[model samples]
Target: MDLLMKSLKIGVNEKLYIKDPESSTLGKNIVEQSILMIDEMGFDNFTFKKLGVKINSNESSIYRYFENKHKLLLYLATWYWGWVEYRMVFATNGISDPVKKLEKAVEILTQNVEEDSSISHVNEVVLNRLVINEYSKSYLVKEVNQENKDGYFVVYKRLVNRLSEMIAAVDGKYPYPISLASNVMEGALHQYFLKENFPTLTNCNDSITPTEFFTNLIFRTLNQNIHG
Candidate 1:
């Protein structure tokens, strides 16, 4: 019955970590506390030593899981993308309209995350904030090309592909489904950054949201191409 009752799981790329962070208590602490610390202090100041103290584990123990904080950040970002894709699927499932599914997918990507108790160790809210603020920095490094070769980005690409298919289903001839999907993902995060720092720069009012903003943009762009 336990096998029948198994919970949903999100998997990050194994190549990004020396050990899976979900396998034990100490490993789970490294993930859960790292998310809290990185969210509290920016990534530059976050270290395995500091995380060790916070989690009451040796620095070496944390190192057993990740090579460095950069890899940890990559791991977190990958996990978050998988989580977002999970939420997107749940939000859009059983909805027959492809366009409506795409709209829900946009909202899932853009809206603020709330804590989910099912995955008790990982806090989706802080993880979401971290992704919005720090996700791009995870890949904007000199080693990004090398990391890409290692499949560090598969989960992110999976989300893009999943979303792009929705676009293709809505309008098979839509010339830029991949580009638009990528834009919608990054633009949603960018809007949160803008809204948090420079609210005046965006029209993301309480009534009109970043999700609405991008949803309209995607539909209009695709529809225009369809009619032309």
Candidate 2:
């Protein structure tokens, strides 16, 4: 009877055992496999079965960590944000000048897009379709609304504000509005990405890359603001 009670106590504390090295490694493996599958099949097409096969585990094992596909995608999205934040922090580290900061920020953005082409493509497709096709779906609508309420756009706004303050610091008499310039810069990047990836509608040649276009346009915008 004492042995039985001890066993029950151990069972109850099994989650505490999750700190064990083997269990931690298994957990990392699951997330790593999920990311691999997402990069290969994209978020929409990724399935528990696929991840299970990839990790040599089963659907039940994945469900132990993630509640469902939506939860898994959320995890992936959060992971992507972590990656972006890491890059942004490293890229902007030690840069105090506002104009230099803005330039570095734009450079980081372009480099991130370039480095994570597959993930970026998947995100673009999902976000674009969500805005158009799935807005009426409750989950989709809620996700989109939540993103607008608390995600990248907020970060972007803060970055813009920083850039504006930097611009103000540089020149007291500068006429170009920072907020407007930030919007234009973001718009230019979006348009450049779309045109580079979907040139048929954009009516532009495929010779130019998004990075190239973004670099040129960003410098041109800054130049115009300073000169014109």
Candidate 3:
């Protein structure tokens, strides 16, 4: 898996950046430090100027890679989804049972993220936190319609579609596969947020994880037995 990830280059939309952050050392530093800064400070307070200071470069240098902080956030979010899709494919590669495959997929999506040692520059752990906390901001904007038309969110959409297909495979008669798949993905993040900030609102504590809840919900919704 390490070798596979190292060899793999998670592609972001070319339109999302002025330059590809993965193409150069300085560009890579911009991406790496931005993830750390955004996770530490929160995306609303994060800025390219702050990131440039952290990376020891001028603010203009950061702009050479990304047009603005919003674009940078979109880049990070898109990259994270691409990485997730890779993990999903790798995890369920040989599983013949669709139920088991869908269960594993849910586990991958809802479980807390751990750092991947294969990718040294980007911290998957911190990036995951950023996604959980700030992913909605990336698209909840006035330009969202234009951005969507430009394919800035293809990676995320693809991940959802993959999960949707898995749900369909498991239960061919399930009418709301896509709707349920999307809800699982979005609900996991919301549940994590609730677990962190509003503990009283969510049952996902140290023992009761979002994974277990979603797994149970999926099987029950499809009228399938997990142990079957």
For model 1, give the 10-residue run with minimal summed lDDT: 1-10
Candidates' C-alpha lDDT: 0.86, 0.50, 0.90
Highest-scoring model, TM-score? 3
**Per-residue lDDT of 84-131 in model 1, one digit per residue for the tens?**
887788779888998888888888887777655447678877899999
Local error of candidate 1 at residue 40 (angstroms): 0.7
The segments of candidate 3 whose C-alpha lies over 4 angstroms from its true place after superposition are 224-228
What is the Cα-based lDDT of residue 68 in candidate 1? 87
Which prediction has more favorable TM-score, 2 or 3?
3
lDDT of 2 at 224: 69
When 1 and 2 are scored with lDDT, the better candidate is 1
Tens digit of lDDT per residue, candidate 2, span 7-105? 221011122122321245666576556555665665678788888888788778777766666655444444443434445556677888866765666
Error at 222, model 3, angstroms: 0.5
Q: How far is 30's C-alpha from truth in model 1 (Å)?
A: 0.9
Clashes of each: 0, 0, 0
Q: lDDT, candidate 2, residue 2?
A: 25
Predicted candidate 3 versus true structure: per-residue lDDT over 26-133, tens digit per residue: 998888889999999999899888888898999998888888899999999999999899999999999999989999999998888976645867889889999999
- Please report how far candidate 3 places residue 48 from its true position, in Å: 1.1
